[model samples]
Target: MSLNVLITGGAGYVGSHVVKTLEKSGYFTVVYDNLSTGRADWIPDAELVVGDIGDQAALSRVFKRYSFDAVIHLAARVSAPESIKKPLRYYADNLCGSIALLKQSRKHQIPCFIHASSAAVYGNPGVAPVGENAPLLPINPYGASKMMAERAIMDISGSSDMRWTILRYFNVAGADVKTCVGQRPENPVHLIPKACRAAGLGQDISIFGDDYDTIDGSCVRDYIHVKDLAHIHLLALEYLAGKNPSIVLNCGLGRGSSVKEVLNTAQRVSGKNFTVNRKPRRPGDAPVLVADNALLKKTLNWTPRYQNVSEIIETSWICHQRLTGRRSKN
Candidate 1:
């Protein structure tokens, strides 16, 4: 029998791609999302439970209904800038909701948990290629919330039979290679997609800051393709199945790309030029964050298929055209 998995926030950008990967691997998936950011159309193939992650009563009902072998918790308010303005909201939703989920998982006796974490937990690590053991010094509320949630998982798992894999994602970009699913326009805050949409519409894109201590005086990030990250999730599930010890791993390309580099690539891929504006730095913004993905690669025996920044931007450009009904210039 196929393992039944419960994926919270499985309809959002990363969550939807993870659902597709899991379902394609022959696992039965039930996506539980609040639809605040996730759309119903994203996960058309799997079951969906529309509810807030903070709603323990609702989550418990679903947990009682299904014998889930594992739970992939991806549902969280994910905006770093927004989290700075609303710190309590981030803690309540990301931290408290995770606690609730852990409670329900223990109650239901779920064997495994796959958490979608972020490199933001290592805010401004002052070092490139940050490893899993780096001190979690989150500079923003979003990162702090994720860090606390990971701690909650670790503490709970130490006392229970729950096994987990925490994948601390760097910058996740690109879409499915087949163009089946990608980041939607709803609250487009990421750099690549924002640049693609601006280029498509002939609108100007703004760089948050241009005075960081990076190569281009702009922020640098390790942009991993969403498909590659999705594959890591699959590998994470398999690792848990093989009775590997619960582990934390960094997910990225082990390299860095500047913000201006992303904008340039998006323009080149879309075959359109848009104005670029430099704005003051936003709070909680990191100067540079590159992941030391050696653990993830060695642990899961994984390799990324899309290694080029141009290829990653090209896929996002295609997704932008499809979502906006614009013709691709190339």
Candidate 2:
């Protein structure tokens, strides 16, 4: 029998990709989003409910209406800087909202729950290739909120009947190779998307910090293609189907790329020399955050396809061009 999947925030960048992948895999998919950062047009085929996760009444209605076998919780406040400025709002939206979602899922008796966690949970780790057991010293409120929610989910996992998978993703980049869906947030902050937009608009881009102890004197991050991350989620669901306990996995390529390297790749791919200015590093900015994907690969036998820097930049650049209708140099 096919599974009935409810994807919260399914109209957003990563969630929308997961929705499409699940639909293509023949799952009956339903999208629940408030359209705060998500677009209605992105989720084309799925049944979308424009609602907030914090609203328990609306959540009850949706769960009661659909017999969901699994729930992929992707809706959360994801800005690091904004989270610092509005810590209470981040906790309310990311932590409180997730608590509400978990309670509702328990009431609905969903079998499997997948959460979208972040690599920021490990703030400025002194070691490379950080793992699930790495010390979770989140540097900012956004990461703290996610860690809190993850703890809540784990606590409920034993009492509730639902199994869960907490995937701590690194810098998610690239786009759907088919270009069916791409990163199109109303106010973009991610490095790749922001750079793409700047290149498209012929505007100068800025690197937050340049004195970091990386190879290029800039902060380093592990970039995972969105499609690859979606595939990991599917694999995680399948893994949890036979297990009783909740699982935690880091979703990344286990490789690091410096900020300057990414910008250079974008310039090379687009053949446009967009001006870049180095600025003071923002507060809570980590020098390096790379994932130790050994568990992800060993546990699920998953391998990333779009692990190349050029491929990541090219796909992102193409998607940006398609949306803005501007020709990048190349």
Candidate 3:
């Protein structure tokens, strides 16, 4: 029998891609999501259970019904700026919900657990291309909640037979290479999706800050393509199945792109130009965050295919237009 995997928040952008990849790889997937930011259509082929991760009763029912060999936890609030405004919500969803999931996983005796962490945990690191060993000094409540979640996973796994893999992702952007699964434009919180939407509709794109201590005075990030990030999750699952020890990996391209640079790339790729509105730096904004992906390469023996910013933006632009009922410019 094929191994059954329980994917929390599997209908979201990254989770949907992972579900497709795993399904293609012959794994049976069951998606559990709250439908807050995820859509049911995103995972058409897999079984989807509409529920929140914090609801132990709901999780208990699913665990009893499905014999899950592993659990991939991805459900949580992900907006940094919004987290600052509503910190308690972030804590409740990201931190407490994660602990609840961990409890259920332990009770159910799930052997493998993969967590979706963020580079925000290493907020404003003193070094460029931050590594897995860097100190986690989160600047925002979102990051803090993710950090706490990581700690909880470690604490739980230390006392049990559950092996865990924590993937600390940088700015995950772009669409699937096949353009089937991409980010939705409704209330986009990320920069690339927002930029793609503005370019599609001929509107102004907002630049959060232009006075940061970096190239072009704008914050720098290491935007990894969503497909590439999804591929790594598959690799992590395979590694775990091999009875490998618990590990943490940073997911990125090992380089940085300024916000202005990405805006220019989006315009060029979409064949559209729009005005950039500069605003004061938002709180919880990091100055620069680039991942040191050397460890990931060595561990997973994997390389990202969509390394160019323009290529990534092109796929995103195409998917954005398709979803928004707009024609892509030639």
Candidate 4:
């Protein structure tokens, strides 16, 4: 028999991808989202519950209704610059809202949890190829919020019959192979999608900083294709159901991409050259952040397929045009 999974924020980018992946593997999913950032059009198959995670009453109703085998929590605010300006909102939405979900999980004895975390929690590790064992010193409120949520998950798992996997994602980019379901236009802060939008529109792309201590003097990030990232989440969910191991892993390609390199790749993939402008560095921007996925490979035996940048950009470009309704190019 297939297990039932509760996926919060299932109508969002990565959450929707996970829902599609899980359904292919024969898992029934129930999506709980308030539609704040998630779009209803994303989850075309699953049953969606329109409610907030902070609404404890709603969570209680859902928990009583469904026999959930796992809870994949993906609902949270995800922006560093915005978090810095509104730390309280980050805590309330990301951290406090997580606590409410954990309470429900514990109340209903949900067996597994796969949390969607971010590499921002590592915040300028001051080391290349940062490992899971590396110190977590988040410099921004968004990172701090993720860290606090992780802590809550751990605290609840230790005392309850719950197994958890926290997947700290690097720069997740690209879209699904088809133009059917990809990121929405309102996605504010992802690098590749924004770049794709610029390339598709024939607008200038902004490289935040050009003086970083990297090969191209631009900020470096470990870009993992969104499809690969979603698979890791599926693997984590399966591992938790079968083995029930508490694991924390970094999801990435164990390499770095400079901002300028990404822009050039975007232009090449789209067959369109957009202007590039370098401005002063954005505050709280890290010079370099790459992942060391040794633990991820050993623990989950996962391998990435989209190791090249052009392929990711190609898919992203298609999705960007689709997102913008194939607008007439300038």
- Please give the lDDT score for candidate 2: 0.87
Cα displacement (angstroms), candidate 4, residue 68, comes to: 0.7
Candidate 4 lDDT over residue span 230-283, tens digit each: 899888887888866798999999999899989888888888888898889887
Candidate 3 regions with alpha-carbon error over 4 angstroms: 177-179, 326-330
Per-residue lDDT over 1-330 for candidate 3, one digit per residue giving the tens place of the 0 to 100 score: 258999999999889999998998999999999999888988999999999889999999999999999999999899999999999999999999999899889999999999999999998897898999999999999999999999999999988999999999999989874654747775677889888988988889888889988989999999899889989989999989889999999999999999999999888888889999999999999999999999899999989999877788888888887777743332
RMSD to the true structure for each prediction, in A, is: 2.2, 2.3, 2.1, 1.9
Q: What residue pairs are clashing in model 4? A: none
Candidate number of the best lDDT: 3
| Tens digits of per-residue lDDT for model 1, 175-201 | 874654747643478888888879878
- Estimated TM-score per prediction? 0.96, 0.96, 0.97, 0.96
- Candidate 2 structure quality by residue, lDDT tens digits, 1-330: 368899999998888888888888888899999998888778789999999989999999999999988999999988888888999998998999999999999987888999999998898888888989999999999899999999999888778788898999899989875764747722457988877877777788899999988898999999999999989877887777777467799999999999999998888888887899989999988899999999889989999989677798888888777766632333
Quality of model 3 by C-alpha lDDT: 0.91
Report every candidate's CA lDDT.
Answer: 0.90, 0.87, 0.91, 0.87
Candidate 4 colliding pairs, count: 0
- Report the C-alpha displacement of residue 92, candidate 4, in angstroms: 0.7
